[model samples]
Target: MELTRLKKKLVTAVKGHKLLKDKRDELMRQFLDLVRENMALRQKVEAGILSANKNFVIAKAGMSEQILNTALMSPKQEVYLEAGKKNVMSVDIPVFETKTRTADANDVYSYGFAFTSGDLDGAVKSLADILPDMLRLAEVEKSCQLMASEIEKTRRRVNALEHVIIPETQQNIKYITMKLDENERSTQIRLMKVKDMMLEEAHHYKEKEVMVE
Candidate 1:
């Protein structure tokens, strides 16, 4: 009975190990995809920021410091960001939405065109255009972190079952089965010797009866 139970446990451990391995593989695939996307998005965000910085530098060179500060002091536009979550393979991925307060394209510009240089306008436009991509980059980065953590946890569980639980259970079952077989052989040998002794005693008794007659 103990051997049977151990065999069942071994089967369960093997099956669980397989399932965890599959999950780990799928998680790895997803993680790699996220990593690729994160790389591309990081490049895009970096380029956009660089371009915006260059435009700002040109605009600053063309204007007085007081004028530049005044031009950017007041904001005509506002953005609302909403956050939510998406569940993927037991991981929660973040979803972000950006909503501009005003639909007017000109709302992004805080200063009148008469006071600001074209370079300032270009810089502002570049920032606005890259906003969504920046947010997306953040989302992808967070997802990658979360997925990586989950993958590690899954890997540990798989290793425990495959390397520890399953092997130990199998070894226990083999030990118990060998012992049971040895006990069965010993019992059979003892019974056979007892039967031979009984037959010899009966033959001796029969011979004595014949002599007495």
Candidate 2:
């Protein structure tokens, strides 16, 4: 290729490399934030589940099987959840919204207070409260997985541009420039040689004229 065209391509490659680096950095920042959120959500979910399980076991030991079954048969409250999406760095992360059917906290205990143990109430309440967080946990985890995949793909592209494409373009430009400069120098040398030969021939012709005189 010509030196001018090679230089133009090199400039374009450099610009592309810069843009990809910026995109990679922004993606890394977003990914890190999601990672932190995922970590916190995981810990909260685990602790909450453990506490709820402990309460459930205590309740089970205290209550008779028939009483426990009656208490669990009908739920006092219902929750409606809808999932949507939000964009983060061009990725669509899930958004979950929970709508509770019952507004009063007292309605959470559907079973009669006289038959069920306090431990059972505590367990039921813990599970209900954690449901939203559990949904949030699902959202964050899925987002993390998606972001990690995108990051990996972007990293590969950035590496290819930085390590391979840009370097190869620069080398090609250098090679073309050197060839053009060499051609220019060779043309200049040939012109000088031709001019010197013309002067030598003219001088001999002038001496012949002087001899004739």
Indicate which candidate wins on TM-score.
1
Model 2 residue 126 CA deviation (Å) reads 0.4
Clashing pairs in 1: none
Write one digit per residue (lDDT tens) for candidate 2, span 108-133: 87799898899999998888878777
Give one digit per residue, the lDDT tens place, for model 1 in 86-199.
998889999998889988766798888897799999999999888889999999999999999999999999989988898899889989999999999999999998888999
At residue 77, candidate 1 shows an lDDT of: 87
Supply the global lDDT for candidate 1.
0.93
Least well predicted 10-residue stretch by lDDT in candidate 1: 103-112
TM-scores vs. true structure, each candidate: 0.91, 0.89
TM-score of 1: 0.91
